[model samples]
Target: VGHLAVQIARARGAYVVATVSPGKLDFLRELGADEVIDYTKGDFTDKVRDIDLVLDPMGGDHAQRSLKVLRRGGVLVSLLDVGDNTRTQAGARDIRVERMSVVPDREGLVELARLIDANKLAVHVAKSFPLDQAGAAHAFLATKPIGKVVLSL
Candidate 1:
């Protein structure tokens, strides 16, 4: 999820900083993340401030922590469920908080396909698990990404 975000954001001309565990730092840097934070070593909120935007796949309590890194009027878009308190506080800072879910739509799908065809975007699949081992796929995701994990039928 984050790998896709990094690629698209870079293509749009934004400098991206990826928050990742230590071992994956080099991989994310290679993917065009200008700066990589090792969450295992320190708190990103403490290390970073005045960010323009955040594409957070980590939901829940992380939403609030990410808010601290945003510049005023910046946006934090989450792919996971965030608690209500995070939304309320964002309003105070003039920051925008939105929870996003991918809706299957033909136009959007076609647009993404076009990007792929144009060579402006790509998908990186890290590992595939058998359909029966969906649990293992989920477990692999908890570790830092190589890219998307797939369920191989």
Candidate 2:
């Protein structure tokens, strides 16, 4: 999701800032992230500020931390939990907090397809395992792959 988001945001002309493990710094850069933070090295909030939007996949405390970087009227879109305290803090700062769930629609799919066709979007499949190797797929995912791990039928 993060990889796709980075590409989509860049394709839309956003100056994207992506945070990743040290090993993935170059990976995000290649995906068109204007700024890439090695999150394992230090706090990303310390380096980023006054942002228009933050797409947070790791919620909870991470969502709370993201609020610090958003400017007034900025938005925080979380894919996971957004605690009440985070919402209250955001409201106080005049920041909008949104929780999003993936609901695929034709319009969205078509847009994504268009992006892919234009070579503006790249899908990285780290590895694929046969359907019978579902357990192996899960284990590979647990290793924190750089891209996606798939289970093929």
Candidate 3:
């Protein structure tokens, strides 16, 4: 989900600093990420600072660290738990942490379709396997393939 957001941001000509899993470096580049950071190699804190926006989906400690990197008056939107109470109490204004679970509306979908039709966006389908091979799909996902994994109907 975060990866998709990065792609959309890049399509809009924004500089995207994407945090991708290992082995997805080439894929991130293909999606036009300005900088791709492998979180396993080093702490993101050492590299990013005073960021204007931080999008967090995997919460817990990541959300806490994101607050540190966010510049004052910046916004942090998390798709997980609303973080600790202290985070909101602090100076992290415009911090919106809520569980987002829904598809886009018709208007939003229309725009998305237009973007795809214009070649401004690319959706990478890693592979399609049989439904019986669900375990295989999970295994392949554990290897961190960029984009999506779909089960053949």
* lDDT per residue as tens, model 3, 26-144: 77777788889998999888898877788888777777777777777677677777556626643446544454565779998887888899887767788888999999999999887
Stretches of model 1 off by over 4 angstroms after superposition: 130-145
Cα lDDT tens digits for candidate 1, 1-153 = 777788778877898888997777888788789999999988999988899998888887898899999999999999887888999999999999888888889997887787788776788888989999999889898985677888987
Ranking according to lDDT, highest score first = 2, 1, 3
Ten residues in sequence with the least summed lDDT for candidate 3: 89-98
Q: List residue ranges in candidate 3 displaced over 4 A.
A: 89-99
Using lDDT as the measure, name the better of candidate 1 and candidate 3.
Answer: 1
Alpha carbon deviation, residue 146, candidate 3 (Å): 2.2
Question: Candidate 2 residues 4-40, lDDT tens each?
Answer: 9999999999999999998889999999999999998
Model 3: residue 151 alpha-carbon error in angstroms: 1.3
Residue 107 CA displacement from its true place in model 2, Å: 0.9
* CA shift of 62, model 2, Å: 0.6
Spell out the clash pairs found in candidate 3: none
Candidate 1 C-alpha error for residue 46, in Å: 2.3
Whole-structure CA lDDT of model 3: 0.76
Instruction: Give me the candidate number with maximum lDDT.
Output: 2
TM-score of 1: 0.84
After superposing candidate 2 on the true structure, give the runs of residues whose Cα lies further than 4 Å from its correct spot: none
Top-TM-score candidate index: 2
